[model samples]
Target: MCSVTLRPALPADLDALSALEQRCFDSDRLSRRSFKKWIKRQHDGLIVAETPERELAGYALVLLQPGTRLARLYSIAVDPSRRGQKLGEQLMDAAEDYAHEERRLYLRLEVRKDNAGAIALYEKRGYRLFGLTPDYYEDHEDALRYQKRLHYQPADAARLHLPWVQQSTPFTCGPACLLMALAALKKQTPNTTEELLLWREATTIFMTAGHGGCHPMGLAIAAKQRGLSAAVWSNQKGALFVDSVRDPDKKAVICALHEHFVKTCRQESIAVHYQDFTATDLDRAISNGKIVLVLISTWRLDGRKAPHWVAISGSDEECFYIHDPDPGEDQAPLDCQHVPITREKFEQMRKYGQAKLRTAVVLGA
Candidate 1:
């Protein structure tokens, strides 16, 4: 039997890693540039199994979500000659341990649907299939999504298992979150058409640059119109996001929309609280069977300073589980669902822009 040592990949391992990628995969191979980049990234983990002879046996790459308790097994490959020595399994163990050490709650990956050996290995490692993506590979092969729970909570029964819904467009995160919340509460299914309609109804018509994003007041009104009771909690009593817009005409339009939404909220008799919704408030609302759609700054999640919307699915003692609508191309939908963020981090992320605007829409039966 051959022995191999597993350790973090260093800059010197770049050539070996690139060569291993070429040997292990005929298509969709990682480039030398990608290997160099991943090796240098502070947040991601790249583990390599080295033989006693100093040759590479296998490698695994795990991508970490900065603000959430999620890690992804982006890639793993065992040298063709070393396949029988269980290097693949050893690398899997190392990847999972690294993620667990980082306090990640879940580790997810996508495998080519036809790769029975890889599927068997993942299943043997306790990764359960969660979804499928058609034509996910360069050769037009479908992919099967799998996720493993690194940390299990006995109190999972106390949390709401809200349905997951990905935003069809970048600006429709607010509507997508509302769609998920409404689906979980009303047992109604969500579709792209309704998502667009909700966006049309709730959009502010102009944001920092592109098309407008949904407003808390507008989302509350949309919820009420959809037969759900709604209330909004916002630190700003007047217009939101107005301070972020430098253009006079854009700011005027935002102010006008805010005024209109406020008027509609009053006419519709929706509860509007001019205050911040604390973590305690979120706990209380979830306990009372209400769904929350919160506006957060995307800086922590993706290093992009933009406002994003997410649904509060559930919570534990230390973390709030979120259903993020925008799961970027590299992430699976399961990676975005029920993503756990610590209360302290949630507080930092819940506000957006220089004004530190905080807003949440609470929905109920």
Candidate 2:
């Protein structure tokens, strides 16, 4: 057995890294250009294991997703001669450590489905299977997706375990959240068609771009239509999102939709409060067996200054658990499920736009 040292891959090691990639993989090998690019990239980590003789023994590459707390183990390879010495495990450990140091909450990877040895190694290292993709490789092999949570918390049995439903489109986050809440309360399964229908029923008709987002009042009305008792809490009394719209025609349409939603809430006898839904209110609602959907700005979560919606699944003294509807492309669905946000941060995230509007809808049986 030979001793090996793990260190960051340097430009000098690019040829060795490229050769190691070729020796390790038959079909999906990283090109020399790719190796050079990653070696110089600041946001990614490329680590190499070298012997005292300056020979490369193994290497691992981890890619970080900006605007998300996720890092991916994009590639790892160990020289065939060094197999029995547990270099693979060492590389895995290094990948995880790098991700944790970068403040990533989870690390994910994809391995070939037929790779029994690799799968066993990952499972032994606490990576759980989350999903699968067909034809994920150049050779037409299926891929097994796995993820490991870097930080773990004890499960709160009292917390509402609401079902998670990802938004189908960019603008349907509110409706996706509403569907999750409805699913939890009614024990019904939600689908994309129903998600779009809810979006159609709740959308405010115009926004900063593309399709409009759902309003709190509109979401409350949609919830009521689904046979749930709904109540809305908002800090603003004036029409929502009107100030954000520049075009007079779009503003008029938004105002009209807001008025209609308000009228529908009154006609359906749903409660509407012109006030902020505090953290105390959130915990109280969950304590009494109700589902709450709150509006939040995405700037804190994804570096995007856009209004988004998420469902409050549970609460603790220190944090509020949320199910974000849009997990983005680089994130696994599990990453967005029951995400814990601290009380102080939650306060900052719950407001949106220049008006700093805060809105929430509480749904009950």
Candidate 3:
């Protein structure tokens, strides 16, 4: 090692950084324009490594998520000649330090699964693999997502704890999520008995696959029947899943269920709110000590357009803490039950249905 130096990146370093990326990787490299953008926009500066002679050795770009304590190590690269000198580790450490200083609760990154050396280095630095994304790279290779929990704030005050349960059947995600929300708010852990009963009470006649999904109004009715207060906010007025069913007979049945739900909601006086729901609404609910069951497309979780549900447990400006009732292989290791999704992405992911519905049901004590 010949006296290396670590420092913040500059707009002047853009060309050198791009050249260094090309030296280290065969594909999926960020362009010089991207590097320049990060230099200008990243809250935490684009970090870099330089030799005593001021030659570029390596660099890393980190992203600080707003409204919450989370950050991401978006990109990192080292000069090929400096590979064995621990330059990558140095850059990684620097990036994490910057994120921690910014009050982030955790730092996350994704790497190719086949890159054993990088995996080992990250694991050694206290990073644990939490998610797996299929074909994440341009070359169609799998990527392992890792997260290292960062310490910040009061422990109990910072997190909203909810009892977690995985869905028993493929189509019962809606009921499972509602069960988790009810149990969390009631402050008691209930088994899948309520989950099954809610499914029976709320399931539409047909969905995108076998069995059916629970309608927003149906869910409210189920909760109301159980002596719990429920509210519904929807983008569409008619029955929800009916539009997805191709069979005329099945669609009719779904329509009947929808009619029954709306009638029951009116009879029980369960207020049905209407709007393009936002995370702020959920955050206020969480702050008021309420629980929420929300619908989202499973496509963001796995590349599939399946309907899914999650229980909102906690919220802040930057993220929504969710208790996902159906954690797939990619989500289980990540403790999807208490997962923190950035507010922006959560708002987008909550949009499902053909109408891009962003609706939620707040279950009360």
lDDT of each: 0.88, 0.85, 0.77
**Compared with the true structure, what per-residue lDDT tens digits does model 1 show for residues 1-365?**
44898888888898888888989999999899888877777434788899989999898999888788778898999999998878888888899999999998778899999999999999998888866878889999999988887877435422646888999998999999999988887988999999999999999999988889999999999999999999999999878888878999998989999999999999999999999899999999999989999999999998899999999988878789898999887666757877878788999999898889999999998
Ranking by TM-score: 1, 2, 3
TM-score of each candidate structure, all chains considered together: 0.81, 0.77, 0.61
TM-score of 1: 0.81
Greater-TM-score candidate between 1 and 3:
1
For model 3, residues 63-125, the per-residue Cα lDDT tens digits are 764333557788898888878887888888889889888877778888998999999999998
Q: Write the per-residue lDDT of candidate 2 for residues 7-67, one digit (tens) a residue.
A: 8988889888888888888898989988887777743478899999999999988977654
Show model 1 residue runs off by greater than 4 Å. Answer: 10-37, 40-44, 80-84, 101-103, 110-154, 157-160, 186-191, 247-249, 328-334
Rank all candidate structures by their lDDT, best first, as comma-separated numbers. Answer: 1, 2, 3
Candidate 3: worst-modelled 10 consecutive residues by lDDT: 152-161
lDDT computed for candidate 2? 0.85
Error of 3 at 253 (Å): 0.9
* Candidate maximizing TM-score: 1
Could you tell me which 10 consecutive residues in candidate 1 have the lowest summed lDDT?
152-161
User: In candidate 2, which residue pairs get closer than 3 Å at backbone N, Cα or C atoms, i.e. clash?
Assistant: none
Clash number for each model = 0, 0, 2
